[model samples]
Target chain A: MTGPKPLSNLMEQFQKLPGIGRKTAERLAFHILKADIKDVARFAESLRDVKEKVSLCSVCGSLTELDPCAICSDPERNKGVICVVEEPHDVFAVERIGEFTGVYHVLMGVLSPLDGVGPEELRIGELVARVEKGGVDEVIVATNPNVEGEATGMYIAKILGGKNTLVTRIARGLPMGGDLEYADEVTLSKAIIGRLKM
Target chain B: MPLYESPAVVLRSMKLGDTDKIITFFTLYYGKLKAVAKGTTKPKSRFAGRVEPFVYCNMIAFGKEKADLLRLNSCDIIEPFGLVRGDFEKLKHAFVSAELVDICQKERDTNMEGFELLLAMWRRLSVEGDARKQDLLLRLFELKYMSTIGFHPFLKSCVDCGGDIIGPKAGFNAIKGGVVCHKCITSDPAASRVFVGSVKLMGKSLEMPFEKLDRLKADPGLQGDIDKIVAGFVKYHIRRNMRSERFLAL
Candidate 1:
């Protein structure tokens, strides 16, 4: 009550955003106060726009301004092949590659038992239903290369293993410019295991 | 101490900042400790796979004599136990192991027994990696951990009366530290009556070596009993519920 209510309120609002802890929120609130009225209005408008415009695609669970999302609705995208990824941001990475022509199924999360995330918490049931509808031939699990991500990929593989769907994981190996000498053993091993004929 | 090295298994890790992680480890020599992994969340991090839970890594950390946390300088993988990371069931049991070790281990104690038990479990899991065997291995580990921590249940006789307790007349009193005979049930009002088979199996399970767990003729019914009995004992002794147990509730 003693402090400026609007300034303190702005700090608390910034704290609600991801990665903005108390200290960072304080900095952000001060920065916003120091900025011109026009820039602050644009920032606030963008925040409101995100909440109003973005909704998850019912079929693939990817966040989008439109239902079914842009990728899911594309006729050029291969409907029979689906890339299962952990979050909506992962879709952006795959899109940036511009190599794959398949549609995606965003899992929204990986299986992280330590953090209490399990199969039920993800959008896996929707993925299975999509598979059961019968045309899907392959589900490419593009989960992160970390432990939880690998575990989630394996779990989804098991669920779809016997359902006539070909389950495959995204390859793990050296990056395009990664030095062999500096590479970790696991990555090197995976690179060896996933080697393709030259 | 100065720059030191030890083989460590990451217990669990949580985000420190947008680009860093605070990782807890159960080390080979230093027992349990936590360390900050700067820029670990970055795409080109050198510490990527080595800091994940259940990875046994040779780490060069900035350890101090009185500090609770060591700043991890660099780590090279010793044994990734990659199968455990890739397999769902194996991953679950591995998480349970890490959780138990993190909860049960004390910092700077440097006890080798706990470290050895966990190392053995991860080694076995990496090789065979069967779902059924993973279950057995975890139950065996719970009993082993209890014994190692001196919470080994009193199986041969009643905890209160020193009478030979077996069959339906036996009841486990967690607060009393073991089984109470039918007549001695008044000693601990919180004693939960369990099947004599479960009590006998817990005692028998303690005798079974880690490798021999897979060969044990365990049926679904007995496995269920072992699950219930062991969970009861662990929860009661730890005096708080563990988050990993519910995730592993197959």
Candidate 2:
């Protein structure tokens, strides 16, 4: 026996979300149905607002409610130092650390050759333009330590070779609180190679 | 469910959902298979880093008979090939090799020769520093890989009539799968002119061992011609252009 058509439709929409199976979708749909009417309206408005209001910042490519983004617009941030990341969400990951005061350049994606992603498909040209515009001192490549990420970093360095800006890659090593014995060979080897003097 | 174990190299991976990834592996015993590694996207997951492409590992996965995707149990990395991943040129060639294997081999079809060829390519690319040697290795892998899968192009003689190909020049017919002598070239209008030197370079690269391959060298023009021929042959047989090919040109 099926319920009202509208209720089933809500459940189907919920099922389309990642990690949401049929049972979870039903549970979510029922919860929304039983919630106060005003609360449900506010929740719907919040979803709609995110879609309409949020967009990539023109200068840095991170998601922002306003043009140029808060970090890029802020005078206190170090415009001379640009940290490169793979996606928009990575900007937030770096922000959570609260230690970095530099602006960011999100490539939107990495150079995934197997998946057909190339330099032309990314925002690397925009980055070079930004750097060549001058005032930039260094570029910190903070892409992941995976093969694609490293390749992306190397390509960025290669293209920016003629420029005066310094290009540096994020160091890879064992995570904090992780045991040496538990670390993978790649991580361990990188740690040894990138070891710093006290 | 039966648990299966094999030494495999990751071909590629795609995000499955919020916290899981579907990883495709070219295994020593099982050939090409895909398995879902649950929660692999999580920062602390045990499967992290081990499932990325170019990683050679021993994997244990569980699945029922005829199941489309196996559930990954665990994997231990044998070699991550970190050096290859760090260099852009080497990494591009490595990805091309992986793409070749991914396209040519069928799912669950055991082709140990193809698997071995891929591993050898990875091993050599990881350590080989000279750019020239690296190019030769990639071409060697392409030729050997095609041969193993039964699509080896005929370079010894005329592909059409099996007559001895005489002179310092010949025409390669991508659709016909080999060199067409001057006589056969007219019949095959699609055939492209290729130097005899390029053809000999390809033959010798295939015949020579990986260690001695460095001794073989080709001029820039010869290299360009052979690159086009090998790429055309691969494209014809695979039926689609590989994404890695574009990056290799860069």
Instruction: Give me the candidate number with maximum TM-score.
Output: 2
Q: B40 in model 1: Cα distance from truth in Å? A: 2.2
Candidate 2 C-alpha lDDT tens digits along B4-38: 79999999988887888899999999889999999
Interface RMSD of each: 1.8, 1.4
Identify the runs in model 2 with alpha carbons over 4 angstroms from their true place.
none
Instruction: Encode model 1's per-residue lDDT on A32-68: one tens digit a residue.
Output: 9999999999998998999999998988888899897
- The parts of candidate 1 lying over 4 Å away from their true place are A1-36, B1-4, B63-68, B166-169, B181-201, B204-217
Candidate 1: the clashing residue pairs are none
Report lDDT (Cα) of residue B108, candidate 1: 67
Best by lDDT: 2
Model 1 lDDT on a 0 to 1 scale? 0.81
TM-score for each predicted model, relative to the true structure:
0.88, 0.96
Query: Share of real interface contacts recovered by each model?
Result: 0.65, 0.67
In terms of docking quality, how is candidate 1 classified? medium
DockQ of each: 0.54, 0.70
